[model samples]
Structures are given as C-alpha cells and as structure tokens.
Target: MERLNAFDIRELERLCPGGVKENVSLAAISRWQIGGTADVIVEPSSVAELCSLRAFIAQEGLPSVVIGDTSNLLFSDEGLRAVCIRLGSRMSSVHIENDIVHAQAGVWVPFLARKIMSAGLTGAEHTCGIPGTLGGLICMNGGSQRKGVGSSVVTVESVDTAGNICHRSVEQCEFSYRSSVYQNNSEVIASAKLSFLSGDKLKIRQEMLSILAERNRKFPRKLPNCGSVFKSNPAMYEKAGPPGAIIESLGFKGACCGGAQVSPHHANFIVNTGVARARDVLTLVSKISRCVLESVGHHIEPEFKFVSVHGEIMPVDEMLKGFFYE
Candidate 1:
C-alpha cells in the first residue's frame, strides 16, 4: 500500500472535514465484526466528496476499496492495506418525484423499501427484508430468484476509475442473475433513479411485512451469517433442488468447524455459532464443498463476495486460490 503523505491527509481533511482515520478497525465496520485494521479509512459524506477522494487515490497510486454497510462482505483477519472509503449517513438520502424514487447509493435498501411503500410505490416490496445498501444491492443484482433490484432501476449514476461521473440507462446496465456492469468494474455507484408502480399504500405495507416475515423464517438471521453460501445451480435447481436441499440430503446440516457451523435451520448457511474466525468459515466451506463433490458428484459453486488473506479486497475467485479447494 502506498503511504498517504502529510499533504494527502491534509487535503482529505480539507475536503471531508472529518479527518482521516488511520489504522481503523475493519471489524467494527463489517456485519461479521471479525477483521483486522485497515491502513487508512475515510468517511465521505456525499457523492462529490467520494469523487474527490477517488481521484486523490488514483493520483497517489494507492489501492482503494469502497464498501457499503458491509452486510454481504467479510474481510480477512489480516485486514486491508489500502484506503477504505465508507459512505456514511451523510449520503443516505431519498426523494420521491411522481412515480420515480431518487435515492443515494448509501441508502439502506430495506429502509428505502419501507419509505417507498409509505409513498404508495410498488415493485420493490421484496427489498423490505434485504439487509444491504442500495449500491451494494444494485452491484449484486440483489433480490429473490424471481425478482430483483434491476427491474426497478431506471438509471444508474456512477463514478468511473478516473472519478468522472457517468449516468447510464437501464438498458446499458447489463444486469443479469446476481451481476451487473459494475460487478467487476473499478467504479462506484453514486445514486440511482428507480421507477415504481402506484399501488394501495396499505396493501404495499402488508406485502412488505409478509416478505420480511418469510425471510426471517427462511434465512435464519438470529446468528451472524453472509446469507447463502452458494447460488443454486440451474440444472440441480430444476432437478435435485437448491444447494440447501442438496446439502441437507447429505445430512450435513448442523455441521461444525470450530465456531462456524452449517445452520441447522437452513443447510446452505454457515452461521457464526458464537465466535467464528474468517479462517473457521473458510475451513467449513472447503469441507462442505469436498463432501458434496464426493457424495453428490456435482461440484457446487460458492457465492462468496469477499474473503481476503493478503489484506486486499479481491474477487472471491482470485482470493480462493491459495485454499485447498478451488
């Protein structure tokens, strides 16, 4: 990691007002609460500030990473050696204009869903229970198998690697199952305009409540977890069923490795039993993959977003290289 000189720090303070925090604990910023410190952390209050920070990182040739709410992510015990920018409460705003909702990327998706429902908006009710920021959800194409955030996205506003703002229509977003144009890009979403249908406010509220209730029953969030570990393979999903059922069929539910355990309530989830380390989770996931391959003869692919060992946030595909199981 390139060390931020005194001038860089001063400039950051000048732009953000809030001084840069050095050696910040990544664990404190994540949902799993189990990572080490990052070399540098910056809180950018708004999209303009984020753009400025991104440009500074580029000019200084420093590795930088953007995180939102940290729900679907898990950092390593080794921590991050790069600049980390978190869009704090300052950027979380929402506005309604006729049938469209304009929301900052930092807005909490579930909370935004409720606000939209209160405004008599439909089509995003399924997001009421999704615990991720709007940017994170849009980046991951987050939602149920049948419905997703992509359907409601009318336009996306993002900053490129050069810190230049660009807006793209829904047609240019390249949204697919669990992915979008930004999936592997060095860009950050600033805000998005989502189109919604007018609906009965009371009916929308009830639908959101029901969705939340169903998610609570099926996802088992009483303990810490990164949602499902794998996306159900299409062939198996149509034939044998989802990854959870395939895992349960092997009687691997309630399986444990140190403090990490496969959730008894949901076979696909590896929940923190109490104090699971990043290593423990990786160990259990590797064991599950091996067992499934040996018994079911189908290589189940994992759906992890972040799991780093070198103190850098890389794609899960590259980060899993050193592990015994691919």
Candidate 2:
C-alpha cells in the first residue's frame, strides 16, 4: 500500500479540482464516531470527476478505497492512511420515472425509500429505516424484514479500478442473503435503476412510518454504534435463534469491554460509550464469537467490515479468524 502525503494531495487536487480535502477526522465521518484522522479524503461530485480521480490513483499506484456513509464499517484507531473517496451528499440524486427509480450511489437509503413511497411504490418500504447509502445497501443486499434491496434492483452501474464503467442486470449481480458479487470485486457502485410496483400512497406512508417507529423503539439511539454487529444465518435461526436472541440468551447483553458494550436494547449491537476505541469493540466481538461457538456449537459471523490503518478492508470475522479470544 502507498501512503499519501502533501505532494500526493496537491496532485489529487489537480486531478479532481474542488473535490479534495485533507487531514479529515475518520471519527467525524464514521457512524461509530471512534477513529483517528484520515490523511486525505476526496468527494467526487460527478461520475466524471470520480473517474478522473480513480484513473490518477491507478496511474500512481496509490492506495485507495471507496466508502458511503460508513454505516457498517469500523476504522482502526491509527486511522486511514490512503486516499478515501467518499460518495455522499454531493453525489446524491434520485429520479423517479413512474415505477422505475434511478438513484445515485450516495443517495441515503431511508430518504430514497420515502421518495419511492411517496410515488406510490411498495417494494421500498422494507428499506425505510436502513441507515446506509444506496451503494452500500446494494453491495450488502441489505434491508430489514428479511427483504433485500437487491430484489428491487433492475440494473446497476459501477466504475472499476481502472476507471472503466460497467453495467449489470439484477441477475448478473449475483445477490443472495446479505451478499452480492460486489463483495468479491473491486468495483465501485456508481448508481442503480430499481423497479417497483404501484401501491396506495397513504398505505405506503403508514407502513414506512410504522417500520421506522419500531426500529427506533428497538435499537439504541443515544450512543454511537454501527447497526447490527452479527449477520443472522438462516441455519442458525432455525437451529438456535437470531443473532440478537442467541447473544442475549448467553447473558452477553450489556456486556462491556472497556468503553464498548453490547447494547442492552439489542444484544447484537456494540455501542461506543463516548470513548470506545476500535480495539475495545474488537475485544467484545471476539468474546461474543468465541462464547457463542463454544456454547451453541455454531459460529456467528460479523456483518461489519473492519478498515485497517493501511486502508485494507475485510469482514471483521475474517480478520479475527483463528485469533478469537486472544
């Protein structure tokens, strides 16, 4: 991995112009609010700008990563040391044409859900409370109520590491339960066109509101935390229970390791108590994984992705493999 510096920042500025920022706080951008400063951050306002910047990065053989909202990610205490390309508010745009929706990668999932609902769309109600961007949701096939956003996807557009644009249909996306082909590739999701069905606007609004209220009542709201810590496996659910229920049954609810604690409201969530470090969260995760595997004879996998200081990202469970309870 290549480390960015003042010289690299200047070159990046020339490549993308006004979309460059330096020495940004990772904690400020991350939902968990618990990381050190990032050396450089770039927010491309358009696909052209993103392509130019990405091409420059590839030409220079520099370390780079793409992120949106940071809702399900955890960064190291040492922070990110590469060029962080953030697709966010500047790139957010949602266009509705009848039952079809064209949404940019940065469009917030909840906001997009509401937009679809207001347009009499029914398939998006399940996403009304997910706190990630459209790109992240698509990559993870994320949604509440066991319904995935991938189900509504018609076509997806992405930019590869070499700055080449690619398009794929829903079938080509290879979406499964909480998984997608993007998880196995280096492609950056740019935008997507989703298909929906017509419904009563009033009925859609009521359902979305009801889902939001239930989420608000069930999840912790006062602290900084990523949504769910563990992914619920279908086999585990049938044999034992959901991740939250299984964790709670093991007396791990409210369990704390330093400043990080398993949320009392939802045992599957690990909340930062004002001063939690990345290490603290990892400790609690290891404890949970080890205890569950030993007690219930099943391994619970993490839903969160861990971002290392070197800008390498991987599933938290994979990173902790063979090192649990250390």
Clashing pairs in 1: none
Residue-level lDDT tens digits of model 2 in 52-101: 88888899888888889899899989988878988888888999999999
Off by over 4 Å in 1: 2-5, 307-312
Indicate the worst ten consecutive residues by lDDT in candidate 2.
317-326
RMSD of each: 2.1, 1.3
lDDT of each: 0.80, 0.89
Error of 2 at 29 (Å): 1.9
Q: Find the candidate with the highest lDDT and give its number.
A: 2
Each model's TM-score? 0.93, 0.97
- Compose the digit string of candidate 1's lDDT tens values, residues 193-237: 999999999999988888878888898778888888877778767
